[model samples]
Target: MLQGKNIHFCISERPIIGEVNIMVAPGELTAIIGPNGAGKSTLFKLLSGDLTCNRGEVSYNGKPLAGFKSNQLAKVRAVMPQHSEVSFPFSSWEIVALGMINDPAAISDRDIQAVMEKLQVWHLRAQAYNMLSGGEKQRVQLARVLVQVWKKQAFPRFILLDEPVSSMDVALQHLVLDFMNELKQRNIGILMVLHDLSLVANYADQVIMMKHGEVMANGHVSEVFTNQNLESLYGYPIHVEKHHEGLGLLVHSLPIHHINQRINKAL
Candidate 1:
């Protein structure tokens, strides 16, 4: 499991994250959701070892994050940031192959092809990475990260993604979430920062709600996703309804007039 205890981060005396504690177990999908400047991405950076915490401990399977070497960490955890820029003229196939650079012999062309096929990007394998559309490029980047930790190991593994589906259309968004669900079945813990509350309601096994660098709520989706909590976190009125088919919860925002009407009724 990947765990963080009392994580705190600050920049020039301005706190960006404070007393954040989280746990991600294998075979689960944990989502971080909040309004802008809520420190969701900053928390991700701290968890991914990109930034050092001011006061806290981050561990992977009981070992401190600082103790792991770069290559050693690569074997167990893969991170896909919000933006990836590839200025070089590398083909999509080559970009995905780069994921296995640490242990090239452990992965083969067949492995790469399988991942590409699964992501439905096999047809674009020969195309240039820079030439692909925004959504296609995102898929390629995801494929690269997936290839890194594809093979199961004795220890737990994880994938940290930041706004991974922001560029995709509705259909592609579901497709990507479905792929993530498949990964969870393989015992890979996934920690993603998502802006879409409805998607969070559907796919997240656990939810962490943050505002102004502190955790407002954290628990199973059903417990933490109440309409009251969402309104407090977003500073606006939100309505949540259960799906008729029992797939998941559907969330909606109340317009200003509707919010005023509700407030008048309460008064």
Candidate 2:
């Protein structure tokens, strides 16, 4: 339902997110993967309407993005910013419930509670948001964002996430991605900026690779995360080796002998 057509965004006449075209099917989890400063965040902002694109158009269904009012947009799309520090001291439950507040339709406290439970932040419901650990705060914020768009059913809602798992631990990282995968299975459109190549390979149905504000590759995960694209993404050598359960893991460009030598030297 979300679509961007030849979208371009520039800062001071220098393009940041170059002309891009994307269509997110109803039940798809698409990952925007690229090296640091490749404008992945910039592209997401444009799609979320936080920043206007210099050219091209982003639309939802048959309606133009620019046509939606702020509240209207809020009901349709929710964005989780990259780095948010809880400057204001509020209860965790209060922060999470804020997501459903803006929603015009009345939502029950029970529904909000359910969302919090699913995010595993129910135990933190009464804690001060500002005082929570980074990962806790991230989970609370994520729960809030989800409640904002969740509604009674998962319609007219799309989530735009920027590095939601960056602060999370390894197990939590998989939990977050697995939750996102479940969202896609439930017909939710998730557009996320993720740095984990292995996770992307396992979970992402669509992958958009960027390099220096340009699209290096965009398509199915397997097609986009090839050895060449991974190398280009990091400006170095990389190899995709067969991995667990028919998956692929990206390895460094160094030869096996050199890898062993380095490991032996370290040992």
Candidate 3:
């Protein structure tokens, strides 16, 4: 489990990530949702140990994150960030293999192969990673993270994905989230930053909504995703509707009351 106690971040003089206590356990898919500037990405970075919080303790399974070496932390929580490449001519297979290069544990080529196969990127193994489309590249990256945390069934695992589905098309979004849920079934905890409320409604077991560096709501999917929550978070009157797959959100545009307030204030 990854947890933060009074976690906070600062950029120059501004507090970009407000302090909060969060506990993420294993075997559940957690979604971090909010509008722009809500500190979702910043919080993800802090939890991934990419950035140090000014005042807080980020512990994993009762051990201080600071106590773990870079490789040790990498082994426990595999993080997939948003950016694509510094330079990329590496084959899809090679890119994933790189994930195992600096590992503290001994992982054979067979392990890397298995991760790619699990992600269904094995056929593209020989293809140059850059040659693939945006979504394909994203999947390859995801496969890389899978390899990073890819341990035999005995050990625990956690996967952190930041906007992984943004590059994917609609159908593929479902595919990716479905795979994420399957990972949870495999006892892999997933902490993902998702922008789509509908996906959060349908797929996530829990939701953590943030705004302007503060957490607005955090609870189970059914409890956290509500019409009132959406309106408060995004300043719009959004509603969730049921679909065959699960829940779907139909945002009927911004509220007339909000528009009226803006008009009256402008007057």
Candidate 4:
């Protein structure tokens, strides 16, 4: 499991994140959700070892994150940030191949093609990466990260993503997330920062709701996704409805009329 204990970070002596703790258990899809300026991205950077924390520590499988050598770390976790740029004119396949640079023998060319096909980017394998659309580029990048931990390993592994499906259309978003769900069966922990509560509601096995760099709630989806918790987290009136057809929870903001009535009554 990947865990953070009392994680703290600061900017110029001002605290950005404080006393935050989280756990990403193997085979679980854990999501972090919060409004803008809630320090979601900063926390992500801290957990992925991109930025060392001002205080506290992060560990993977009981070992400190700082102790792992670069090569050893690559085998345990893969990270795909919110945005990635390819300065050179590399083909989509070449960009995907970058993930295996640490140990090319770990993944085969055939395995790479299979992952690209799963993401529906196999046809664009020869296309220039910089020339693809935003959503298409996102898929190619995801393919890159997926292949890093695609092969099963003796020890558990993890994939840390930041708003991975932000650019994809609705269908593609589900497709990518569905693929992520499948990865859980391989004993890989998945942690991502997501804004779409609906996606979080349906796809996430565990939820971590953050506000001002503090954890407001963290638990199984059913326990943390209450209307009350969401409203308090976002500072807006929200509603969570259970679908009569047994689909799942449907969440939305309260209607404008309801907001006005509540305000009038308070006054």
Candidate of highest lDDT: 4
Give the per-residue lDDT digits (tens) of candidate 2, residues 1-267.
Answer: 899999988889888977788877767888998888999888888888988888999997658898999888887788999877766788999998888767636567897888788778899999999888888889899998888866545464679999888888989888888888666655678988988777787788898888888888889986777888898788766777767566555444677788789889999
- Give the alpha carbon lDDT tens digit for every residue of 130-241 in model 1: 9999999999999999999888677889999999988888998998899888898777999999999999999999999999999999999999899899999998878899
Give the whole-model CA lDDT for all candidates, comma-separated.
Answer: 0.92, 0.82, 0.82, 0.93
Ranking by lDDT: 4, 1, 3, 2
Candidate 3 per-residue lDDT, tens place, 73-95, comes to 87678889987683957899889
TM-score against truth, every candidate: 0.95, 0.89, 0.88, 0.96
How does candidate 1 fare on TM-score? Answer: 0.95
TM-score of 2: 0.89
Off by over 4 Å in 2: 104-106, 152-156, 244-267
Best by TM-score: 4
Error of 4 at 109 (Å): 1.3
- Candidate 1, clashing residue pairs? none
Measured over all alpha carbons after superposition, the RMSD of each candidate to the real structure, in angstroms, is 1.8, 3.4, 3.8, 1.7
Clashes per candidate, residues 3 or more apart or on different chains = 0, 0, 0, 0
Model 4 TM-score on a 0 to 1 scale: 0.96
- Give the CA lDDT, 0 to 100, for residue 198 in model 1: 93
Q: What is the number of residue pairs that collide in model 4?
A: 0
After superposition, which runs of candidate 1 have C-alpha atoms over 4 Å from their true positions? 257-267
